[model samples]
Target: MSVSGDKIRHRYDRLAPWFDSLEGFLEGLIFRRLRKRLWAQVQGEHVLEVGVGTGKNFAFYPDRARMTAIDFSPKMLEQAKRKRERKQLDVHLDLMDVQSLAYADNSFDTVIASFVFCSVPQPRKGLKEIYRVLKPGGQLLLLEHVLSSNKMMAKLMNLLNPLMVRLVGANINRQTVKNVQACPFKSILVDPTSSDMIKLIRAVK
Candidate 1:
C-alpha cells in the first residue's frame, strides 16, 4: 500500500470500534433503506463487495450470490468477520486495497461499493481496478455521498473536506458520478436517494 493508503487504513483501524456507534442514528434514519435498495439490484453469482465495513450489508446479501468482500483496514475486517460468523453468512472476506486488487482480470460478475470511494487515495485508479476485475457486461453498484450540485453547498463542502478527512478519513466533496463516468464503463445511471448528494449509481462494464 502507498503512504496515503496506509494512513487511511490506520485511521479506519482506530475508528473501527466506534464506527457503528458513531453512525448508528444516521444509519437507521437513512442508510439502511438505501442499502437494501442498492443490494436488491445485484445480479450474477460471483460478487465482490469493496470496503465491507463492519459487515453492515451482510443482512442484504443475496442468498445465491457468491460473496467475496474486501477491506483495507484489518480492524474493520475483524469486526466484519465477527458479524459474518454471528449471521452465518457465506462470505469470503479478505484484506485488500481497491486501488490494487489481488484478483485476476474479469474475475467477478458484479462489484459493489458503499460510501467507499471518498476515502480512496486514488479514486480513478480504484475504479479502473474494479473495471479490470469485472467481466464484460458486469455491473458496478455504488451507494455514495457526493459533492452537492448546488454551488453554495458544494463550496461549503469543499471548505470542510480537509477537516472531515482528518476527523473521519473520508472526503465530503467527492464528485463520484463524474469519477465513475471517466472510467471505461459502458453506461452509467445515477439516482439521487437523498437529495442530490447521496446517490445510487449503476454502471456497466
Candidate 2:
C-alpha cells in the first residue's frame, strides 16, 4: 500500500473497536433510511460490497444475494466478521483495497459501496476498479456522503475535510457522484438524501 493508504489503514485499525458506537446513534436517526433506499434498488445475485465496515449493512441485504464484502482495514474486517457470525450471514469477508480489486474483469453482477469513496486515497481509481469488476448491465448501488452542491455547505465540508480525515479517516468534501458519473458506467442515477450531503446512486455497468 502507498503511504496514504497505510495511514488510512492504521487510522481505521485504531478506530475499529469503537467505530460502531460512533455510528450507532446516527444509523437509526438518519443512515437507516438512506441504506434502505440504496438496498431496495439493488438487483442481482452475485454481489460485491466494498467498505463493509463492521458489516452494518448485512441485515439489509436480500437473502438471495450472494455477497463478498471487503475492507482495507483488517481490524475493521475482524469486527465485520463478528457481525457476520452473529447474524449467520452468508457473506465472504476479505481484506482488500478498492483501488486494486483482486477479482477478474466482469466478475460481479452487482456492486455496493456505502460511505466508501470518501476515504479512498484515489477515489477515481477505486471507482474505475468497481467499474471493471461489474458484468455488463450490472448495477452499482451506493449510499454515500458527498460534497454538497450548496456553496456554503460545500465550503464547510472543504474546511472540515482535513480534520475529519485525521479524526476518522473520512473526507467530508469528496464529489463522489461526479466521480461515479465520470467512470466507464453505462448510466448513472442519483437521489439526494440527508440535506443533499448524502446520496443514493445507481450506476449501470
Candidate 3:
C-alpha cells in the first residue's frame, strides 16, 4: 500500500467502532433507500462490493447473489464480520485494497461501491482494478458523494476536503464521474441522486 493508503487504513481502523453511529442519522434518512435502489439492479449471481465499511449495506444484499466484500482496514472488516454474523448474511469479508484487488480478471458479474472512491489514494487505479475484475458486459454501480457542479459549493467542498480527509479518511470534493469515465468501461451513465453532489453512477465493462 502507498503511504496515503496506509494512513487511510489506520484512520478508518481507529474510526471503526464509531463508524455506523457517526453516520446513523444520514443512513436512516437517506442512504438506506439509496442502498436498496443500488442493490436492486444486481445483474448476476456473482458480486463484489468494495469498501464495505462496517457492512452498512449488508442488510440490502441480494439473497441470490454470492457476495464478497472487501476493505483495507482490519478493524473495519472486524466490525463488518460481526454485522455479517449478526444479520446472518452469507458474505465473504476480506482485508483487501481496491487499488490492488486479488481476484482474477473477469471474476465478478457486478461490482458495487457506495460512498467509497473519494477516499481511495489512487481512484483511477482502483477503478481500473474494478474494470479488470468485472466480467465482460458486467456492471459497476456506485453511490458516491462527489464534488459539486455548482461553483460556490464546489469551492466550499474543496476548502473543506483536506480537513475531512484528516478527520474521516474521505475527500468531500472528488470528480467521481469523471474518474469513472477515464476508465475503459464500455459505457457510463450518471444520475445525481442527491442535489448535484451525490450521484448514482453506472458503468459497463
Candidate 4:
C-alpha cells in the first residue's frame, strides 16, 4: 500500500467500530434507499464489491448473484465479516486494496463501489483496476458522492475537503464522475441522484 493508503487504513481502522453509528441518521433517511436502488440495477452472475465498508449493501445484493467484497482496512473488513455472518449473507470478504486487486484479468461480470473513490489516494488507478478485472461487456456500478456542480456548493466542499479527509478519511470534493469518464470504459451512464453531489454511474467495460 502507498503511504496515503496506509494513512487511510489507519484512520478507518480507528473509525471502523463506530462508522455505522456516524452514518446512521443519514443512512436511515436517504443513503439506504439509494443503495438499494443502485444495487437493484446491477445485472450479472458474479459480482465484486470494492470498499465494501461494514457490508451495509449486503442486504440488497441479489440472491442469484455470487458476491465477493473487499476493503483495504483490516478493522473495516472485520466489521464487514460480522455483518455478513449476522445477516447470513453468502459473501466472500477480503482485506484488499483497490489499486492493487488480486483478481485475474476479466475475472468478474460486475464491480460495485459506493462512496469509495473519494478516499482512494489514486482514484484513477483503482478505477483502472476495476476496469481490468471486469469481463468484456461487464458493468461497473457506482453510488458515489462527488464535488458539487453548483459553484457555491463546490467551493464549500473544496474548502472542507481536507478537514473531512483528515477527520474521517473521506474527501467531499472529488470529481469522481469526471474520473470515470476519463477511464477506458466502453460506455458510461452518469446521473446526479442528489443535487449534483451524489451520483449513480454505470460504465461498461
Best candidate, lDDT: 1
- lDDT by residue (1-205, candidate 2, tens digit) is 1239889899999999999898899998988877877788778889999999888888788889888999999999999999888888889998999999999999899999888888899988999999999999998988888888899988888887888888878888888888988898888887643467888888998
Pairs of residues clashing in candidate 4: none
**Candidate ordering by lDDT (highest first):** 1, 3, 4, 2
User: How high is the lDDT of residue 143 in model 3?
Assistant: 95
Model 4 residue 57 distance off true place after TM-score fit, in angstroms: 0.5
lDDT of each: 0.93, 0.87, 0.91, 0.89
Per-residue lDDT tens digits for candidate 4, residues 123-168, read: 9999999999999999999999888888998888888888888887
Candidate 1: tens digits of C-alpha lDDT, residues 1-205: 1238878889999999999999999999999999999999899999999999999999899999999999999999999999998998999999999999999999999999999999998999999999999999999999999999999999999999888888778989888899999998999998744568999999999
- Model 1 clash tally, residue pairs: 0
Which sections of candidate 1 miss by over 4 Å? 1-3, 192-194
For model 3, residues 76-170, the per-residue Cα lDDT tens digits are 99999998888888899888999999999999999999999988999999999999999999999999998888999888998888888888889
- Cα RMSD, each candidate: 1.8, 1.9, 1.7, 1.8
lDDT of 4 at 76: 92
Error of 1 at 15 (Å): 0.7
